[model samples]
Target chain A: MQISQQQRQLIQLFRHPDEVEFSNIDWEALILTGRQNGFLARLYYQLERHQRLEDLPQYAFKHLHSAKVFADAQRQQAIFEANEINNSLSAIEISPVFLKGTAYTLLDHPVAYGRIFNDIDVLVPKPLIEKTEKQMLLYTWFPEPIDEYDQHYYRQWVHEIPPLKHASRRTIADVHHNILPPISGRAPNIDLFTQYKIKTEYQCYVLSPAALTLHSLVHLFFEEDFSKGFRDLSDLHILFSTHYQDEKYWQQLRFLAYETGFTLELFLACHYCEAILQTAIPFTFKHELVAFSPSPMQLKCLNWIFLRVLQPSHPNYESTSYRLARLLAMLRGHIKKMPIRILLYHTGHKLIKAFERGILGRYSDTSSNLQPQPPDKNN
Target chain B: MQLHQLKFDDYIHKMTNDGLCLDLGVGVFRFKSHITSVQQNVYEMYADYNITEDKPADFHACVKLAKGPRHYINPQVHFESDVVTPFLPLPKSQAFPLLEWGMNWCLSAYDFNHFILHAGVIANQQNEAFVFPAPPGSGKSTLTAFLAYSGWRLLSDELAIVTPDSLTISPFVRPVCLKNNSIKLVKDWFPQVKFTDTATDTTKGDVAHFKPPANSVKQINTPAQIKAIIFPRYMPNVPVTVFKLDIIEASEAIASNSFNHNVLGEEGFKTLVKLVENVPCVELQYSDVNEVATFLQNEEW
Candidate 1:
């Protein structure tokens, strides 16, 4: 990815916290970019570790401090909710596997430090998906209402059911039956990931190091939206820098990637993590990674889109090319995700919904700026 | 110089493009609005706040007239504060009030370092502050407005900012939002006071804003030592009876009304317990604003 000037400074700051020349930095742009991209708190922790938190301009200092406070609270809530989910599922003898942001947090991995946790994702054995969801519903979890089509769509064709939100706590939990949507035709066999589960001290199940790395790599690569792409890529960078030094871990990641039919995700992860973040790779693995690179033309198209879409989506640094790139990414993802007929039905349904909302909105007397209506009538 | 000192033309010119930045005592915010009502109201209400191009703007607040091309069909304005917007778009008429509410959200949501209470605060000349922590329809703003005009320095009419682990409070004096029947009552009481044209049928019912006095803005950086927690109940035609609240009751009241006490968690509980014990807590019930003012003034410090 071609990082923006603001993004480069953020990466540079993350790499070397002690070298910040505050006067040269645009405090506003950096904070805005960091906030939009969800890493302000991580940078705060980095500065504190290097004894440079105190050196920040008061403006930057407070913004980072505020982020740290917020992240710390979320971490506590994440732990609490994870415990609750674990205890609830334990009743049915089902061990749900936590994934992504929540899993990294439960493992106490450095990558989880200062990460924002909005929801908890858990993978259940396909046989126990219904049983697990039932247990969750018994204890404060209810479906965030969706239309009949969406409900059918998730149960029939997708990896996960509709997300369950806690009644009082408002925490969302996604129950996945497989890593990828089963309809995608590219989903790996569930056994490839399920066999490598590691239970944390919290009695929660998580993927092993190599397995978790592959899961994250595949998740990022298969996504349609890249609003949080830069942050996800950074996650891969940290995952590699921490684990790739061991030849065994690197070999295991490649083996699983190939076995799971996600060699492309593995190749892209390594390429961007090293190329973008300068995540160091051992001298031995460098030449072998080059062998997995896509053809020059394909790589060119991928790079052009990824580079534009990965930067912070803030107005200050957002380029004119981002919107077009995002549209291309979304289109590429849809084509990759569903078969032809289902894709047409889904796309057509969404267009009709948008048009219906607009027509209904037009009937309301909203032309007059002075008259008051319900706050959300227009949106 | 305070914002009023800027030439009217330059002020509008600045707000239309680069935004007008001002210090609101607790933090500085850069406010931008293209809506005519928002500009007109802000020009009248926020005249006393200091204008600056400070290195770090604590919040970037704006009321934009555009939602998209379809915005021309509906003509709505949305309040955006920094990166997060907790509010939905309102009719363009509500833009000024929407921005004011947005500013409050920014302070309480982003600035978690301080304990922000959902209350009003006004202090005596000795800088001994009286905090009025109450719910909506409690006549809190009307009381705060009456006293702020009657020589008491206004610290804040909403979101009372307290320094953690201390009784010290900072001034966040902006325009006091007076809602519904209280708007007419306040206008009648202070005939000369300038107020925004009341926006009707808002979520809070008809509402108008009262500009705070210039003297309060002068002490924007000054801190106050909180001496009392007063919970006012506007009972009609009643005597100004001051009832004492025990420490536990006071602490519970303060805790429930606090915006960030839960966010701060354990430290917030400890600081609040200490504050309730330290301050004299009382409930003042009265119908007449003048009587309530006299009762407060004559209280033992």
Candidate 2:
């Protein structure tokens, strides 16, 4: 697809952050709407990465946008500190996965130091979630009770509970019990996080640099949960290029994968990061991993996998399509483990709904007006 | 109650006998003196007039009023320490009684960051809360009104606070606002139901308020755990049939209906999933209040 005018200007700004020469389009308008929104970042970094970052406009160098960057970084520091305080009091022992900005802060990057973080992501053991919640309560972080049944459900089932938000602090802490589904589902061996765990400087976080990379890829491909856009991709590029610099790191990563039961996931991440970011994964390592990941359907499956993960904002799409796509992606993720019959039942139901919405337009938002008013109900 | 006594900073006012306490943010308005006048407007609109006292206005924009020991109280408006106060003139005595029911007028003045959802909730005799989650036209308020009148305890006829782990409902049991024709349908079914006045040309068609069922008065402070989640899609002529929804589907629905899910992240996702697994979820299709009530009562909850 041809890039929109704003997209083209965004591409220019991102590639040449040092050059601020726009003819008619205001520089503030260019960066504020296009770049700040993460749209342009998504297009260039996630969708198209062959584009060079050196070509983007340079607003920071002019000292005008420098304050914005500084403020963002300071905001990140505040979040990190607040999260650290929560961690000190939390009951569950959580390992921080140094995601984008947090990771950048950890690695001492020369770029903007204090970026604003929306949340603090931490991985926790599944069994310890209840205890963690009790710990959260000690700090006055409580979930609003929607219903008793909902409370029972979250406490008993599910991967993680809704984030415990500090109402006054406005800090959101995501507590994950499992990295992957414990049931027959895609992304197995989530607990393997224990193997490659390492502590960070600020807190006692178990981080596997390689697992972190794979997790980022899982988030990118399967989760398509791309709210950060260019910034996240940039982090991926930096981490990949900087961490996996030696043959020792590559062999260690491969060994780490074999132990963790994520040989395919690690290999795919390495291959794609290199292909997309022009990241310098060693040729010998790339060739061997490619031989192991020989499936044409990997990319096709990856598309829906990521699409489901990213779950776009296309309100025009049918709810059934959204649900079916999610189910299919999930089933495929756990193909070998989960029962085919159960998957079939779930997938069939979703597919039928998708078909109904697609062909008959039975559930169009456009007909939301056709919704029966109170006593007018005549379904 | 007058408007001046409601101010949080001015607590030196004389208390009045037979006055209702008003808690509006930081300002307290002891408003029993004006209750009769306020009730005049409220009765014209078919809504009850009452006083809320000693309520901590957790939100910054609230205005409280109540009757003090010896004198009438005024409207009290509180502002957060750091933020500049917005201009909110206390409505005159005639406008006083209609404030709470008419607070929707102040909706535009608030920030647009949050999406406003219109729905209601009620708890069974067991105190298990059932969230009737729906968009504006789903007849949630109408159904909530019927249920409240049918002896079920009304929890809230508005916002259902869906938190990270549980769906907590506020015990704001005032009156259920029945819009447009639902008012007539309700009146025809329950001829004994006391309605305020039917105000016309309002947003939700012709609107009126139903006296909260007596049980609601007692349960106004009780918060119920969400036991059943019912998505009501009222088809004007359709027979009442409830379709049981599966956990996965219900989880998705709860997530979408949630006030602040995305901000909650993995915890939110897990909460919704957990809720679906435990709650008996269903999609109810009905036209008549009688069938809807019967179906709800008969469900194997």
TM-score of chain B of 2: 0.66
**Per-candidate RMSD, Å:** 3.6, 22.1
DockQ score of each predicted structure, in the order shown: 0.38, 0.01
Kindly provide the TM-score of model 1 when superposed on the true structure, using C-alpha atoms.
0.94
Expressed as tens digits, the lDDT of each residue in B132-206 for candidate 2 is 877778888888888888888887676554434555554556556777878898998789877666656543456
DockQ score for model 2:
0.01
lDDT of 1 by residue, A240-320 (tens): 888866788888787888789888778788777776677787766666767778999999998888767765567665666
**Tens digit of per-residue lDDT, candidate 1, span B1-301:** 8788999899999888878989887787888888888888888898888898754677888988745555767677777765565565677778888888888877876887888888899999999899998988778889999999889999988878888889999999988889898888888888888899888878888878988888998999999999899999888889888889998888888887888786776667777987987888888898888998887788785
Runs in model 1 with CA error above 4 Å? A1-4, A362-379, B66-74, B82-84
Candidate 1 colliding pairs: none
Question: How far does residue A138 in candidate 2 sit from its true spot (Å)?
Answer: 0.9
**Chain A TM-score from candidate 2:** 0.63
Model 1 chain A lDDT-worst window of ten: A370-379
Give lDDT tens digits, candidate 2, residues A1-379.
Answer: 2223544455444444345354444443343333344333232332123433334344312222222333343445544644564465443444444443454455454222324455555565666666766777677666654444445444544456766666676566666666554444554466565566655665545455666666655554443234443344444555577665666667767766676566776666665555434567777787778655837886666644433333222222225655566656555554543357755755675576556554533323232222222211111
